[model samples]
Target: MKKEILGGLRFFLLMTVLCGGVYTLAVTGVAQLVFPHQANGSLMKEDSKVIGSSLIGQNFTDESYFHGRPSEVSQLSPYASEYKEMITERTQAIQEENGSTSAVPADLVMGSASGIDPHISVAGANYQAKRIADSRNVEIQRINDIIEANKEKDLLTGNEYINVLVVNAALNRLE
Candidate 1:
């Protein structure tokens, strides 16, 4: 009986070390080495020292800067005591105005889970082109040409997408 109990304890200890220690180190170490860009704390340093992931969306409302996709994340007015109630009231009002029972698109209605998405839909990007061009005193046609140039072509169907971060970076290059 004593020998059996000791054997069982040793087996449990061996399994724990092998599964917990070795497996975790191998997986995490390999992942960090293989994908250095996604390694801890690398993404935050890629953009301006704003301390946000460029992969996420941010709210940009100024007419001079291009706006990102609409954010669904809402904060209660400081005057309101209950933030959830405030959100409910505002959503109800929007629903009544739209006269639709369908929920808004997840991307359109609610902010991306990361709250820092930098991309916008083609339509959303186009909508802001006029405002950005007007603010910069650049020709709208030139802005349109830039947009067209940045579009990513699809391999099979030749579909194109304009990455917002890349476009904004290009805008910064414009004199």
Candidate 2:
């Protein structure tokens, strides 16, 4: 019985080292080697200064900048009156801001679950492109070009999105 107990202890230690230490090191090394930028948080830098991460969203209320989804969306129950009211208000505000009499994109009114989703749908970006162009005093085509340049497409889902930070960063570079 004592020998059997010793064997079990050895096995446990071996597995712990292999799984916890060795396996972790291997995976981390591969990540660092192959995806260095992403492994390091996918941060965006400007003049050697860290501006933001490509993987996370930042709020931009300036009309000169393209906006992301409404970050202040309530997390209340969907059936709650407050949630409905908030959505209505956001939709109206988006319409007013974008001068669009048509339907607004759902993402513009709804908050992402993480509240840090960097990517907004192409439609959402397009909705605010006019406002951004007018505010920045740039041509609408220039804004469209920037949107196209920063657009990302998911291969599996075939969905297109644009990182707001990236777009805003590019906008900042405009003369």
Candidate 3:
């Protein structure tokens, strides 16, 4: 019984150190070397100030900026229909601000599963292109060009996606 107890204790300690310490360090080291930007939360900067990250979303309610989907961190929970209504009303208000006849894209009114997805669908970006252009006093064609330039194609399906934060950053640079 003594020998069995000792053996079990040794195995548990060995596995804990090996799995919790060595393996974690090894994987983290490899990730740091291979994908330093992504491994470090894909943070984005402006004027050397860390404005946000490429992996998370934030509210963009101003008329001049292209908005991401409504964040779940609102007074009404994301699952509630009232929350969706709020998103719809906001999008429509922006559309009205720009006098855009085009309908609002679905993604703009719906939050991503993570509630803070940086990427918006291609359709979502284009839907706001006119509004952004009008508010910025830039040509619509130029806005479309910026959208196309920022699109990221899916590896498996080849569908286009846009990173909202990056695109907004690029737009800020246009000024």
Candidate 4:
């Protein structure tokens, strides 16, 4: 019985070292070697200063900048009254901000699945173009062009998305 107990102890130690230490190191090393940019949090930089990560959303309430989707750290249930009320409020706010009577895009009113998604649907970006243009005192065409340039297509769905941070950065660069 003592010998059996010793054997089990050895097995446990071996697995703890192999799985906890060695496996973790191997995966991290592979990630660093193969995808260094992503492994490093996909940070965006400006003038050698870290601005933000491309993988995370930022809250921009300034009228001069385009806004991202509503961020909810914990998503409310779709059937909940709070969720319905929040959606209604967001839709009204977007309409008022953009001076649009058109229906607001779903992305504008809904929180993203991750709640930290940096990208918004292309339509969502365009919906705010007028406000951004007015605030920046630039032509609407310029804002649209910037949106066009930064738009990315999803691999599976082929739907276009624009990173709000990138678009806002481009807006800042406008002379």
Candidate 5:
């Protein structure tokens, strides 16, 4: 009985080390090496200061900068009410005005799970072009051209998405 219990303890310890420590380290190391860019790309450096992450979107309200898709994520309202109430009220208003069913596009309704999605629908990007152009004192044609240039081809079918971070980076490079 004593021998059996000792053997069982040893087996459990060996399995824990193999499955938890060794496996986790091996997989993580390999993943980091295989996707180095993705692992490091989240860090954004600006003027020697880490400004933000490319993985998340910042709230850019200035007309000079392009706007991202509408965010459905809401904070605590000044009024004391349930969080769901706020969302329901806003969603109901939108549905009544737009006549959209509950099947609204993912981008149009709920915020990204990460709350920092850097990609926007092509339509959302285009919608902000005019405002951006006007704010930058640039020609609308020029802005339209930029949007067209950055437009992504349909990957599988008709779904096209623009990486906002990439486009904004390119825009900064423009003279």
Candidate 6:
């Protein structure tokens, strides 16, 4: 009985040290070395100031800037009635701007599964191109160029996406 109890305790300690300490350190060390930028949250900076992370979506509703998908958190407002009215008005404005009688793109009004997806479908970005172009005082062609330049394509997954935060930051840096 004594030997069995001692062996069990030894096994528990071994796992505790290996899984809890060594495994964690090894994984962290490898991540820090290999993916330092992403491991550090893929932060984007402007003028040496950290603006936002490319991996996270942000709320942008300015007439000049391209707006992201409707945030799920925004739906949790206490004033549900007012929120619905505001959203309806906002959607109407977008529809008018897009010159489309059909509904806006799903990604535009539908919050992503993560609720903070940084990338939006190319179509989603293009939907706001006109407004953003006019607001920035930059030609529409130049804005298109910026969008194409910053587009992300995954060869394996065949998924194309544009990181809104990164695109917006690049837009800010445009001469």
Compared with the true structure, all predictions reach lDDT values of 0.62, 0.90, 0.84, 0.91, 0.66, 0.80
The prediction achieving the highest lDDT against the true structure is 4
Compose the digit string of candidate 4's lDDT tens values, residues 31-82.
9999999999998887889889888999999999989988885367889998
Give lDDT: candidate 1, residue 142. 74
lDDT of 5 by residue, 1-175 (tens): 9999999999999999999999998987887999875767666665577756767777665556665555555565536566557656656754553444443344534466566777777766665666667667778778677777887767678777676766676566555
RMSD of each: 8.0, 2.6, 3.4, 2.0, 6.9, 4.6
By lDDT, highest first, what's the ranking? 4, 2, 3, 6, 5, 1
Pairs that clash in candidate 1: 56-116, 56-117, 56-118, 57-116, 57-117, 72-111
Cα-based lDDT at residue 16, candidate 2: 100
Q: What shift in Å separates residue 60 of candidate 3 from its native position after superposition? A: 1.7
Using TM-score as the measure, which candidate wins? 4
Put down candidate 1 lDDT per residue, 1-175, tens digits, no spaces.
Answer: 9999999999999999999999988888998989866666335433455444556655655556665654554564546767546555555643443344444322334444455666655544565577688888999887787778786765886555566666775676776
Model 4 spans > 4 angstroms off: 73-82
Question: lDDT per residue, candidate 6, 1-175, as tens digits?
Answer: 9999999999999999999999999998999999999989989999999999888888877767767876574544646787667667767877887666666766776566677777787778888888788888889888788789989897999877788888888788786
Clashes of 5: 0
Error of 3 at 134 (Å): 3.0
Give residue 11's lDDT in candidate 6 (0 to 100): 100
- For residue 166, model 5's alpha carbon misses the true position, in angstroms, by 2.3
Q: Answer with 1 or 3, whichever has the higher lDDT.
A: 3
Residue pairs clashing in model 2 are: none
Model 3 per-residue lDDT tens digits across residues 43-153: 999999987898888788787877887667465677899887888787787578657767777677666777887887898888878878888998989889889999999
Candidate 1 to truth, TM? 0.56
